[model samples]
Structure formats: C-alpha cells, structure tokens
Target chain A: MRIITAEQISAAVAELCIRANRELPEDIVSAMNRAAADEPWPVAKNTLEVLCRNIAAAEEMELPVCQDTGMACVFVRLGQDVHIEGDFRAAVDEGVRRGYELGYLRKSVVADPLRRINTGDNTPAVITLELVPGEKLELTVLPKGFGSENMSRLAMLKPADGVEGVKRFVVDAVRKAASNPCPPVVVGVGIGGTFDKAAALAKHALLRPIDCPNQDEFYARLEEDMLREINSLGIGPQGFGGHTTALGVNIETMPTHVAGLPVAVNISCHVTRRASMEL
Target chain B: MEYRLKTPVNREELNRLRAGDMVYLSGEVYTARDAAHKRMTECLDRGELLPFEIRDSAIYYVGPTPEPPGRVIGSAGPTTSGRMDAYSPRLLDLGQKLMIGKGLRSREVIDAMVRNGAVYLAAMGGAGALMSACIKSARVICWEDLGCEAVRLLEVEDMPLTVAIDSLGGNIYESGPAAYLESLKGGK
Candidate 1:
C-alpha cells in the first residue's frame, strides 16, 4: 500500500489556496473568451472584456480576481489501497487555516449563521470524501461564494412531469435569478437522483470545463437546450440586458427511483474559482 | 417613456460621481428588504430618528463583503430587494425618495414608489469589485455594532446605475428583459 504523508497534503492545500485565488483556470478563461466572441450586447460584451482583463490582471499581479474569495470546499477521493500517515481532517483544516491567512482570502465563514460572526480562519472547510479503488488520492479545491451559492435550487418533480418539467424548472430558475447570479453565469443542472444526491451531483457538474460536452448525448442535448432557453430571457451580463445571460449549461445525471424525477440547479458566477491536485 | 423628476437630476451634474452616490439623492423613492428596512419601520412606529435622514434620500439594499487591505472595500454588491418588502411602506410614508438595488421589488414597495413619486434604481449586482473602484470613501454614520451592516456614508462619483423603477412606475427588470427578448425574436 502506498503511504501519503500529512505534510504533503498540507503543502498541496497551501499551494492550491493561493493558486486558485490568483489564477483563473485556463479552461474557464478560454471559455470566457469564446463567450465574449458570441455575446451580442454591447454592455455585456464590455462586461466580459472587464472580466477577461480582471482574469489576466489577477494572474499578473498575483491578486484575487474577486473580493469574496469564498469558503474552501475540498473534494477528496481517498484510495482503499493507500494509507494516510496522520489525522486527515486536522491536516486538511490546518492547510485551510494556513491558506486563508497567507493567501489573504476573506474569512467569510461565521461560526453561527444567525449571529453572523466570522470564524477568522475560514477553517473546517466543507470537505467531502469518497473512497475509490485506486492507490492515488485526488483532491479538488472549490472556493464557492455565497451570491451564486445562495441561488442554487432543488426540485422533486413527479415522474409524470417528465423532461418538460425539468426544462421549465431550469428556465424558471434562470428567470427568477435574473441579474442576481452575476449574468453570463454557468448553470450546472443535475437530474435524476434523490434530494441530497442531486444537489451533490449538481455541484460536481461545475468542476467540468465550461465548453466540454457531457458524455451522454441526450443529457448533452438537454444542456444545449437549457442554455438557449436561459439566454432567451435576456437577463444579460450583470442583468443590464443582452444576449450573454449564461455562458453555458452543464448537466450531470444518474439513475433514480421510479416515482421521483429530482432536479437541482447549481449556479456559478463567471469567476469560476476551482483547482485540482493528485497525490 | 421620458418623465421629468420633481427632484431633477441633470445628466451633466451626475457625470462627475463616485462608487457611492451621494447627491442629496432626492426625486421620489421606496424602501424594501432585510435587516435595515425592518428596523427603519419599527423606528417609524415609535417615531425615532433613523440612522440617516430618509427624507428625499435613497436607501440601497445591499450587504457587502469586508474590505481588504490597501483597498476601500470588498465585494460591495446589492442583494435582492424583495426580502425588504414587509418594511418599506412605513419609510415611504415619510417621503423616502428612491430605492436602489437588484431583483424584483415587492408589490408593496412598488405601490409605495408610485404613491410617493419614488424611483427604484438597479445597480449592477456581482459587479462589486468594479463598483468598489467608484467609491471614494465609506464611513459608518450609525449602527456600528452591525459591522458591515452599518449605515455607511459612501462618497461616490459617476457611479453607473440604470433606472429600473422610475417615478412613473416604469419597471425595467420586467420590461427591459421582455423588450430585449422581443427584439431578438423579431430579429432586430
């Protein structure tokens, strides 16, 4: 069995925290460039220009692109054949504490939601673990902001509602969100799973590149259709009115119960902050 | 569609502005959403002094992120105005001039805007960093205990904002999107 040291995890997390804040992933940057090419609204096109420029400037200056650096959300895939040298959660938290402090990321996470006091370190990151068959551990870091995260929605539609219901839910979500999720948004649609499972899948869908196609042809088509319907709302970038309402729609689906057709829409802003590592 | 404001705002005069618009911002407005509105109306019942003089002054519903170093502020973006619906009408009774923010305003806030000759301006949401650049300075006038929620006196210059709801009851969030969609459909 391969043994992964705690020090290595800590170092990787520290590096990812700074890198993710300063760098816009190349895939996301390329996708924004493509969106700018197709965008028809002058104001939205201008906004996309600013977004692209911000991405470039952020990299050049080693500064965060957006002020709300977001809460650290780490996805870990641990291998059954590998052993962690020490306490995994503590090691992960320590890494996050160090990253937020050193990276100058916002300490947005409050100890209590109602009282609304900051935790100071942004520690105890939203960590999710999955056991896999391989010997290597895979980790993905997503710094998720509240504005777009607050806009996420889940629905448990009847089996009779069918694809039409799914499409309607997505369209309605985009319409209601209008200008709020920072237009030229990316809509991650998760279909066909239980409640929590659908939400998780929706978030997982965002990890994919904006321009990439879902392997399932039918689902890929659904994504395209939703993209068209959403942009047709004319919410445009920053909701000032234009053709660039959403950059893309990504759908991820799995098998579900005979009675339920669960759908979740996880919205992400143009910033699209995330990173991945393997150890 | 062009309606003159009782409290006129000349375009040239508005050109030289900053991130936080401070023009003695008059010309009819409504109030809506969240924590501030709730307390404003509660104070109205007791006839207490509001944090700022609400008469002829616009109230923007926003919750911004904490500022970073060598920077004036963080993601100072607008929140949904609908959440403030329950508390808006009371302030409008005192002649609140304008309500600024994003999302759909509640029917009550809209009614107050129309009745009180108020306007609702839509500031770009999620354009916080861009918006912050326009703010010259921000000082807490009241509610210091609210932290980021304090009533801040923001000095702004030439802040770009669209008139979403004018005194004439022109609803942009509703009509703007529909109009653009129609033009697109008609192949304009």
Candidate 2:
C-alpha cells in the first residue's frame, strides 16, 4: 500500500485554499468568453463584459471573484489501494483551517443556521469521502456562495412528469428564483436518482467542466433544451433585460428505482468557484 | 439615460429618475447588509441615533472583503437585496432616499420607495474586482466587530449603476424581462 504523509495533505490543502480563493478557474474563463460571444442581447453581453473584467481585476488584485468567499466543501476520493499515514479527517480539517486563515477568505461558515453566529475560521468543511480503486487521492474544493446555494431545490416528481415535467420544474425553479440567485447562471440538473442521490448528482454535475459533454445523447439534448428554455425566460444578466440568462445547463443522471423519479436543480452564478488536486 | 445624483436628495430629484435609466452617483453613501441592517433597525426601534445619518443618503447593501495592501477595498459586490427587504421600508420611512444593491426589491420596499421618493439601483453582481476600482476610499465607520459586515464609509468615482426601481414605481426588474419576453413572442 502507498501511504501518503499527513504533512503532504496539510501543505496541499493550504495552497489549494489560497489559490482557489485568488484565481478564477480557466475552464470557467473560457466558458464565459464563449457565452459572451454567443449572447444575442446587448445588455446581457455588456454584463458579461463586466464579468470578464472582474475576473481579470480579481486576478490582478489577488482577491476573490466575489466578496462572498463562501462555504468550504471538500470532496475526497480515497483510494482503497493506499494507506493514509495519519488521521485523514483531522488532516482535511487542518488543511481547511490553515488555508482559510492564510487565504484571508471570509469566515462564512456559521455555527448555527438560525442563530447565524460566524465560525471565525471557516473550519469544519462539509466533507464527503468515497473509497475508490486507485493509489491516488483526489480533492475538490468548492467555495459555494449563499446567494445561489439558498436557491437550490430538490423534488420527487411522479413518473408521469417524465422529461417534460422535469423541464417544467427546472424552468419554474428559475422563474421563482428570478433575480435572487444572480442570473447569467449555470444550472446543474440531476435526474433519475433517489431523492438524496439526485441532489448529490446535481451538485456533482457542477464540477464538470463547462464545455464537457454528458456522454448520454438524450441527457445532452435535455441540457440544450433546458438552456434554450431558461434563456428564453428573459431573466438576462443580473436579472435585468438581456438575451443570456444561463451560461449552460448541465445534467447528470444515474439509474434509479423504477417506482420513483427524483430530480434536483442546483443553480450557480457566474462566480462558480471550485478547484481540484490529485495526490 | 444618465443623471448625476447628489446626496441628501429629496422628492423632486428622485422623481426625475426611473427604472433602466443610467445614473452616476456622487456624494456620500454608507454600506450595510444583513447584520448591520438588523442592528441599525433595532437601534432605531430603541430611539437611538444611528451610527450614521439616513436622511437623503444612499446605503449600499454589501459586505466587502478586507482590502489587500494598497487597495481601498477587496472584491466588493452586492449581496442579494431580498435579505434586507424586511428592514428597508422602515429605514426608508426614516428618511433614507436611495438603496444600492443587486436583485429585486420587495413590493413593500418599492412602495416605500414611491411614497418616500427614494430610488433603488443595481450594481453588477459578481463584478467585484471592477467594482473595487470605483471605490476611491473606504474606512470603517461603525460595527467593526462585525468584520466584513462592518458599517463602512466609501468614496466612489464614476461608479456606473442602472436604476432598477425609481420613485415613480417604474421597476426595471419587472419591465426588462417583460419587454424582452414580449419581443421574443413577437419574433422581433
């Protein structure tokens, strides 16, 4: 078994936190450029121009893309063929704690949902671990903002709704959201899993690169259709008038029980901040 | 589509602006968001003088990052406006004339804007780095313990904003979408 030292995890986590906070990802940059070029609405195009400029400024200033530095979510894929030399969970938390402090990220993680007490250092990252069949471990850090995170929704629709029902629900969710979630958004739709699994699938869909394909043709078509429908809503950039409402609609699905049709729509704004590393 | 607004503005000046009009804001604007708004409103209920004056001044609903060295502020952008809607009408009634934020205002807040002759503006959300460049100066004026949520005073220049809700009940948030949607149906 290949044992990875705890020290390595610590250093990587610290750097990941700082880098993720300071730099906008390249895939997102390319996607935004493409979206701007393709947007038909003048106002929405102008909004994308501001967004591109913001990305450049953030990089030059070495600041985050948005002031809402967001909640720390770490997804770890641990390999069964490998051994960790130290307490894995503690190592991860230590990375998050050190990274947050060193990065000067906002301490947005609150102690209680209702009381809203800030946990000074953005610690206790919402960690998800899956054991896989490799010698390498992968970590993805997502800094999810409250504006879009608050608008995430999940539902178990009857099988009758099928794909058409899914379309309606996703459109309605965006409509109800209106300007609240920060428009010119990226939408991740997860379908066909169990209720909880669907939600996770939708979130994982966000980790996919903006230009990547869904592999399944039907799902890819659904994504295109959803994008067309959502943008047609005229929510536009920043919810003011424009042609582009959503940058992309991504759908990730898993085979599920025959009796139930579960779906979830997770909306992310232009500031979709995430980064990953393998060690 | 552009007008220069002066602080401590009254009914007449505000009435001249409407939703979707571009406006250049000058003069003093204070910053507040979820925590600061609650505290300020509670203090108002207690009949205490607010840390800053509300009459005719604009309050930006934002929580900004700590400034990096040599910068006035960092990654300053508008948070969702609905979160502050509950406290805004009360403050508008207390003589606040302008609110700068992202997203739509609640009906009650818009109504308060009409009755009190206040205007609402939308800054580009997620455009923080660009937004920071407009802030010529920033200093904490109150609630420092709140960290980024602290009430700060900002001096800005050429900060471009669009009127989203004006004193005349013209809401761009509603109208912009409707106009485009109608055009879409008209196939224009």
Candidate 3:
C-alpha cells in the first residue's frame, strides 16, 4: 500500500490551484490559436488575436487569464491501495484557501446560494473522488468560471429523441448562449446515464485533450458533426460572428436505463484551466 | 469605426458612437458587479448617497483578483453585464452614461440606454491580465468586505473596448452575427 500524507496532498493542491490559474493548458492554448488563424470574419479574427494576446500577457504577468478565477473544483482519482492520513476533504479545502491567498486569486465561492455572503477564503472545494486500481493518487484542480457554466444545459429526452434530438438540444443551447459563454468555447456533451451522472460526464469530458477525439468512432463522428453545426451558427469568437464558434466538442457516454436518455452540455471558455499532479 | 474616448463621456460623444465600433477609453472608471450593484441599489432605495457619484460616470462590471505586491491592481476583466440588468436601468436614468462589460444586455436595459443616451462597451472578456495593463491605478470606494466584488475606482489609459450597444439602440450582439450570416448567404 502507498501512504500519502494530508500535508503532502494539501501542498500539491495549493500549487495546482496557483498553476491552473496562472497558466492555461497547452492544448487549450493551441486550440485558440488554430481557431484564430482559421476564423473568416474580420471582427472574429481580431477578437481571437486579442484573446491570444491575453494568454501571452498572462504568462508574462503571472496573473490569471481571466478575473473570474472561479470555484475550486478538485477531482481526485484515488487508488484502492493508497491510504491517506488525516481528513481528506479538509486537506483539499485548506489547499484551496491557501492557494487563493498565496496566488492572489479571487475567492468567488459563497457559503450559501441564498445568503450570498462571501466565504472570505475560497474554501470547501467541489470535490469528486473516484476509486481506481493503481497505487498512485492523481489530483486535478479545475478552475471553472461561471460565464460558460451558467450557459450549460441538460435534457432528459425520450428514447425516441435519439441522436438528432441531442444534436438539436446542444446546438440550441449554444445559440441561446451566444456571446455570453465567451466564444470560441469548448463544449462537452454527456449522453446516457442518470440525470446527475450525465452532468458529471459532460464536465469530465472537458478534461479530455481537445485535439484527441473520443476513441469510439461513432462518438468521434458525432463530435465532428456537432462542431461543424455549432460553428455554422456564426457565433464566432466572442460571438462577434465568425466560423469558429467552438474550438472543440467532446462527448462522454455510458450505459443507461431503458427509459432514460439524459444529456448535459458543459460549456467552457477559451481559458479553461486544469492542473494535475500525482502523489 | 474607432475612436479615442475619455470619461465622463457626455450625451454628444455617446451619440457619435455606434454598435461594433472599437474605442480606446482613458480616464477614471468605476468598477462594480453583482454584489456591489445590489448594495448600491439598496443604498439609493434608502435615499442614501452612493459612495461615488454616478452621473456621467462609466461603471465597469468587473470583480478583479487581489493585486500582487507593487502592482496597482490584479487581473481585472469584465464580468457578464446581464446580471446587473435589473439595477442598470435605474442607474441609467440617473445619468450614468457608459457601462463596460461583456455579454448581451437585457431588452429593458437596451431600452434604457436608448432613452438615457448611454452606451455599452465590451471589454475583451477573459483578458484580465491584458485589461489590468490598461488600468494605471485602483482604489476601493465601498463594501471592502465584499472582497473582489467591492466597488473600485480605476484610472485606465487607453482601455480597448467594443461598442456593444450604442445610444441609438444599435446592438452588436444582434448585428455582428446577422451581418456574417447574410454575407455567408450572399456568397453562395
């Protein structure tokens, strides 16, 4: 068995939070570059160019690409052979609190939705733990901003709705989102499973490298078709109008009940940030 | 069209602006977003003076990160303007002239802009680091407990913005896409 101390876990997570905010993943950065180069509309092209500058400036300034440093979403892949000392959740929260403070990232989390008071420290990260077979413990800190998150949608379609219905729902959601989600956006579509699981699958799908297609040929084709359709909407970069409304489309699916055809669309801005480490 | 605009931009200057035009704004701009907007509106409702003057002011819809050592401000970028729609029309009627943010405005907010001779500008969203470069200085005005959401006064030099909505009711969110779609149809 591999033993990981909470102090170690907390320290790693803190660095991840700082890293995720200050630096964007290379995959996301390249996707934006490709979109900018390929955009047709003049306004859209200019918008993409400016966005690239932002990315570059962020690296130089050691600041977050966006001011909405977002809620600390921690994803942990824990191995069955691993034993963690101390309270695991508390360790994660401590990391977020210190990371936001040390990194000068915004503490955007609120203690209660209705109460609307700032939590002071960006504590109590949204944690997702999955148990796997290996002895290595992997942690990914996804800083998800609300601009794109608020634009996401879900549908519980009838079995008859099928693929076409899913496509329509996804396109309509993007159309409705328009300039709000900060195009060129990254879309994650979750099909199958129950309602909540489908939503989780959609978000999880975003962690997949944008350049890598789903291993399944069928899902890969669906992603391409949806990307084409979404770009056809002329929403472009920043929705100022162009051919690159979405940088990529990713779909995740799993087996579901006979009655269920659940779908969730998780939209991410160009600044989609996640940093991972293994302990 | 591109223009160099300095606040407090008056009704005449706003009328010259049109949707889709790029502008570089330089002057003292006030910052506030969801939380601070709520607080400001509540203060007005109680017949209390706001912490800063609103008339002819350019209010930025942003919640910036904490500044690092020696820097005047942290990464400061616009938040969604839609969230403040409910409170904006009242501020517009109070003679607030310019609003800097990203995203579509409510129809009611647009109508108020047209009525009040105001304009909406879109600062490049997610360009916080770059945006902060334009801001020379920042100081909290009120609601410090709100942290990032506290209202601040920022002195910016040549802050780039797109005229998303002009005083005459032109809206880039509507026109930009429709024009692109029309050209696509025209091509075929």
Q: Evaluated with TM-score, which candidate comes out highest?
A: 3
Q: Looking at model 1 chain A, which ten-residue stretch has the lowest summed lDDT?
A: A58-67
**Could you arrange the candidates by TM-score from highest to lowest?**
3, 2, 1
Q: Is candidate 2 or candidate 3 better by TM-score?
A: 3
Model 1 residue B186 CA deviation (Å) reads: 3.2
**Is 1 or 3 the stronger prediction by DockQ?**
3
Candidate with better TM-score, 1 vs 3: 3
User: Candidate 1: misplaced stretches above 4 Å?
Assistant: A1-11, A50-64, A113-120, B1-48, B58-65, B141-147
Please give, for residues B91-142, the per-residue lDDT of candidate 1 as tens digits: 7777676666766667788788778776666666655555556566666666
In candidate 3, what are the lDDT values of residues A161-242, reduced to their tens digit?
Answer: 9999999999999999999989889999999999999999999998888899999999999999999999999888887878
TM-score of 2: 0.96
Model 1 C-alpha lDDT per residue in residues A6-97, reported as the tens digit of each score: 88898788778768877877777887888788887665677677667667765654456665577888889999999999989988888888
- Separately for all candidates shown, the number of backbone clashes (residues 3 or more apart, or on different chains) is 13, 0, 0
Q: What is the TM-score of chain A alone in each candidate?
A: 0.97, 0.96, 0.99
Which is better, 1 or 2, measured by TM-score?
2
Worst 10 residues of 1 chain B by lDDT: B14-23
In model 3, the runs with Cα more than 4 Å from the true position are none
TM-score of each: 0.83, 0.96, 0.99
Clashes (candidate 2) = 0
DockQ numbers for every candidate? 0.27, 0.74, 0.86
How much of the true A–B contact set does each candidate keep?
Answer: 0.23, 0.71, 0.78
